[model samples]
Target: MKLTELADLYRRMLLIRRAEERLQKLFADGQVPGFLHLSIGQEAVPVGVSSALSDRDTVSSNHRGHGHTLAKGVDLTGFFAEILGKATGLCKGRGGSMHVADLSKGMLGANGIVGAGLPITTGSALAHKMQRQGHVAAVYFGDGALAEGVLHECLNIAKLWSLPILFVCENNGWSEFSPTDRQLATNLEKLGKAFAMKYRSVDGNVIADVAAAAGKLVGPMRRYPAPAILECRTTRVRGHYEGDRQDYRDAGEIAALEARDPIRLAAEALAEAGAAPDLIAGIAAEVDAEIEAAAEAALAAPLPKSADILADVYTPAEV
Candidate 1:
């Protein structure tokens, strides 16, 4: 990749990192309502995969999906506003943190259900195939969702029809409070092979590695149009939700995960690739300012009007 492209990746990853950090603080301060899921240590998965996707391609996101949504080109202001429950949000504050969606950007919303995105992604890919649009669908889900029966059904159908879709499993080691190994006996690669689908596992913390793998896999899927699975071994720095006690986790696990922070890893790689220290610093400052302004705007934005509660709730019949 060119220097500019690498810089853009780093910038995107940094934006996710900083944005999540700020959200954690905001949630702690009681600014954000409801439970919040932060994809802090797992920035590379979305940044890498999204780098290979076009705006024409669609993506379905899981609950901890701010990074995925942002990487897929959703506006940061609207994202923050939605999380803040403001009227100007992507879903007019109705979707909150777990349901932000922007169809114009090909982001099909972040799902609250564990494995909901799997079938949604498959359906989108099927539509692309039937319409001959040549577009692919990428779905982001966690290790927890791996056991969901819908995932198996989606994979089976995707392979059966050779649909163009990417199933990205962000294996963050925990299925909520329990370790994933304790819940699911089968590994992702084996699961893919069982369904006769292509599979690849990459270190999810390294942004460059993720981008290259996703590009290689997704590029072929767009052309040949077959289902593929990319399992990214990642870390979930925050608890399952904001204010989670997290008594289930090991004492030093979070600290160790922080040591492998994706933003820091990407920044280091960018530096090794000859990006200037000053340039990296400038980008960080710019992202910080952008997020700060977005938060301020979201805080000042009005809440959804009570009188118009049913206005956008349902579709109307054609005249």
Candidate 2:
């Protein structure tokens, strides 16, 4: 737990927090189009996992993927622009909130379908396996996505081929409108055993725990391409999104999770390790400014033109 590493983690997590907060505001103000899924409380999983990977490694993220994208070094301006559906976006405004992607940064995209990123990551892992490259593929999804049939199929293929893949399950305990208890028959870790792959379960609320666990898995995957699963038990600070009323949750359950907010936990750990209080404040201020600038820029930016509706969907013949 070096002071510098802890500080950097804190800074990254804060950026996710502030950026999503700004997105929430913009979503409500009608600036951002399409459905939005926020990675508000589960910042540690993405940041921690990404910390262990090289830039060449890739991640396939779920709808709640802003944290994962940012952790993988996606440009904040470009991401915000994509959410705003601006031409300056990574997808050139063709893919909106649910489809923001930057292959250069190794983020596949935030897929709209439940558990769709699993197979995508498995394919990426297979590509790396064929090249015999040291790069690893990580896919982040919620507990909700576990219900998808493709996830199990992908898991089987990755393990069978011993592909370098990390399947991260951000088990926040809800599948959108359905609760995990109702939808899932067994635990996620148990499913890993059926696939005969390496598996780990961690308290995703603590970034340190997540970092340590993630570090342990990264090395093995590179050495011997095998499928691995890390089940992070975390929570969502906001409703599924800004507008979700969260009618399914009890007041007490939300309160309990909020009381154990991971951002606060990380800040406290850093402060105890001799990080200056003002340094933490400075980081917070910096993130706030960056997010605000992105929001303003996105709002003033041009939207995709009606003429370009199907341009990116299929490449036109080179004439």
| Candidate 1, lDDT over the whole model | 0.91
Candidate 2, residues 10-79, lDDT tens digits: the string is 8899998888888888888888888888888899988889888887898988778889988998888888
Q: Ten-residue segment with the worst summed lDDT in candidate 1?
A: 307-316
Q: Supply candidate 2's per-residue lDDT for 257.
A: 85
Itemize residue pairs with steric clashes in candidate 1: none
**What CA RMSD would candidate 1 show?**
1.0
Clashes of each: 0, 1
Candidate 2 segments exceeding 4 Å error: none
Best by lDDT: 1
